[model samples]
Target: MGADNQFPVIQYVNEAGSLKQDEVKLHKEQLYQFYFMMVRARMMDKKCLNLQRQGRIGTYVQYEGQEAAQVGSALAVEDGDWMFPTYRDHAATMSFGHSLRNLFLYWKGRLEGSIPPEGRNIFPPAVPIASQLLHAAGAAWAEKKKNSDRVSIVYFGDGATSEGDFHEGLNFASVFHAPVVFFNQNNGYAISVPMEKQMKSKTIAQKGLAYDIPSLRIDGNDILAVYHETVKAVARARSGGGPTLIEAVTWRYGAHTTADDPSKYRDQQESEIRRKTTDPLLRVERLLKNQGWWKEEEKERMEAEITKEINQALKEAEKFKPADIDELFDHVFAEPVWPIEEQRKQHKRLSREGIQ
Candidate 1:
């Protein structure tokens, strides 16, 4: 059988929001918490897109349609766990307790934006493809050597799986039994490239099998499935079961970044249709209604509250003085290298000449 046939997409909730698995852990209060958290991340993502267009921030990476995959996996980890995120994975970082103000500041091009909350081990968003996987693997290996219970979770895309670091990270993790979760958000496209065009393997999960890691494929739009399966992966890693790879079969309904036009390469109608049929937020909303647990007033209140929270973070970010240009050169290395010193001097000279 083909890998796709062998690894069926798992889900605890259908796209219509109907519960498929009657697990005891899917209680009322916790489900509501998950709903609220996803909503917060979604709202923040949308607002950041608007902020980018308004020239209030720098280029942004939108994660509009894959909230369940990011949020569910984020919520599965415990405090002190490590998270290495790609530029598009802020939803995961935020759900894992990154500061909203810092997130805003990040897009505003301030170094402070990279700082995680006190005691939180969230890494700065990696703009480079597939590099953070090594960081995650190394950190997890470090924790294992210390005999600590902490595990690391790294987020990447379908395109990243093609990078050598992805394979190296997995191979190292598998061989050394690094306690990490390699979470792949298969959003159907690597920017303009589709999955079929980029990979010959029928499924991303099968890639993990090559490294001898336990792997699973799950519905990224289903929060229940994402949360439960991720919880299992985390538990296994924590218990010294090494690493697990999860390929979240999902989609991104927007541009790869604010700088790119997705419409140039793909049909927009598919996104429009998928928003109705497979939006992670909509699926959860359906589930809530199906359970008779949804209230229009509560949803409205949640939206209003989240909007206010986003606004407060925005205000705090805007209040900062423009970042010093030296911050860029200084942070590049512990001591100034010749090239950096030359660049810093050139920039300062340009500023004085009003050419900046």
Candidate 2:
């Protein structure tokens, strides 16, 4: 059997929102909390897309269809645990205590956006693909050396598995027994390239096997499954069980970013079909309804509260003065190199002359 067939997708909830696994018992409050986070993530995603379209923010990445994967995994980690998110992982970051106003500032190209809240170990969103994997591994190793219980969780897309850092990070983690979770959101595409065209490997989880790290493929749309599986991996890491690779099978319902057009590569109909059948939020809604806990009035109130919060964050983000262009050159080095200084000067000169 191929890796795809070999690694069965783990799921706690089926399409009908019924619990498939009796072993995993979830309380009513926990389910409500998960449902709220998923709804908040979806609303934030939609708001960001609108902000990008209105030119209020720069190119934005949407995580509409992957809310369960992001939110569930984020909630699995504790207060001091480290989080390394990608450009498309705002949902995860936000769930992990990242401020909404700062998230807004990030898309506006402000340096302050990268700063996490006090006491939060959230790293700036990694724009350079799989590079954060190494950073996460190194951090996890450092924590292990310090004999701390804190583990690091690094988020990346399926495309990142093709990068050298992905393999190196996994190998190093395996060899050193780094306390890290290699979380891969296999959204079926690496930008315009589908997973099949990108790699011959049947599943991303199989790649971890070569490194001798325990790995599993899970239904990313099932929030409960993602949370429970992640909790297990994190516990193992804390207990010196080394690392685990998780492949979250999910889909993105929008363009790779606001700058790219999905219609150029795949059928838009596929997204529509998935939205109807496998939407993460819809699944949670179904579960709530099945339990007779879903209230339309409560949902409406939640929507209103979330919208108000997002609008307030936007206002706060907009209140900041425009960022200094020199920030780009200054943060690259402790002391500016001659070339950087010269470039900064030249940029200032051009600005003084009102040149575009």
Highest lDDT: which candidate?
Answer: 2
Model 1 lDDT per residue over 1-356, tens place: 89988899998889898888876355778887888898999999999999999988888999998899999999999999999999988889898999999999999899999999999999998888999999999999999999999999999999999999999999999999999999999988999998899999999999988899999999999988999999999999999899999999998989999999998998999999999899888887888888888888988998899999999999998999888877888888887799999999999999999997
Candidate 2 regions exceeding 4 Å error are none
Residue 292 C-alpha lDDT in model 1: 88
Question: How would you encode candidate 2's per-residue C-alpha lDDT over 1-356 as one tens digit per residue?
Answer: 88878899999998788989988776778887898888899999999889888988888989899999999999999999999999999999999999999999999999989999999999999999899999999999999999999999999999999999999999999999999999999999999999999999999999998999999999999999999999999999999999999999999999999889899889999999999999988888888888888888878888898889999999999999988877889888888799989999999999999984
TM-scores of all candidate predictions against the true structure: 0.98, 0.98
Ten-residue region with minimum lDDT total, candidate 1? 19-28
State residue 134's C-alpha deviation in candidate 2, in Å.
Answer: 0.2
Choose the strongest candidate by TM-score. Answer: 2
Global lDDT of model 2? 0.93
